[model samples]
Target: MLKAGEELDMRINELKKYDTITIDNLKEIIDTHLFLTNVFSDISGHNNRSLASKYLHFHVPNMFYIFDSRAIQGAKSYVMSDKQLRASLAPFGDKEYIELVIRLFTFQEHVKSQFGMTVTPRVIDSFLLNY
Candidate 1:
């Protein structure tokens, strides 16, 4: 377990090298942290997606999102249109995740530029939840 923890730590450290994660670098990051691919199952009678999201978000807030139904809906509505989001979803892979991050970053930049609202990723996430 200590070795696993150390490996995870190193993977996270690799992620830290990116000032802003992009499609170009996302694969290497995810490849290192392969555990990120685990989806929730009811076998444990627990919401593992939420658990894992919180865990990863706690570590890399700017690069990850916790997408339950509401969050996914919110992300759909947060963008200009569903079609735009759908278009972005193509060739989905690690690229899709990076695109989501890019969308959030773009949304943050848009808000800052248009509304003069400087916000953190948490605030942006809240906006996604509420928007």
Candidate 2:
């Protein structure tokens, strides 16, 4: 849990920079701040994937996905099930997280190519959720 004002403001301000950051820059941010790894440190115990992803998605919607158990399950069966996905997810980090992001980006491009740009990340997420 973040503190009342200054801490929250700082976090929000920090997150704003991620909106246009590249994958490598994102990795550095994650490494430096432990954005996902140390999320919910105040109240929620330790590394919580759901909360982490939700927090990241709230800040960087176009780049991050809300990766909960359901999303992972759906992705395993419907999107990525290869050895690479397994290896990437087995030990989650900046590299693996960015890999997942790239996979989603690729899938979004494929969806756009197949069904036109009418499809958005939400649409793809809906499909993944239902799948």
lDDT of 2 by residue, 18-87 (tens): 5433434444434423454554565567656556666656665544566665555665554552455435
lDDT of candidate 1 over 27-123, digit per residue (tens): 5544442354433332354435456556666787665565455665665566543345435544343443444544565666677789997565677
Whole-model lDDT per candidate: 0.56, 0.53
TM values, all candidates = 0.57, 0.56
The top-ranked prediction according to TM-score is 1
In model 1, pairs of residues that clash are none
In lDDT terms, which candidate is top?
1
> Once superposed on the true structure, which residue ranges of model 2 sit more than 4 Å away at CA?
1-36, 81-99
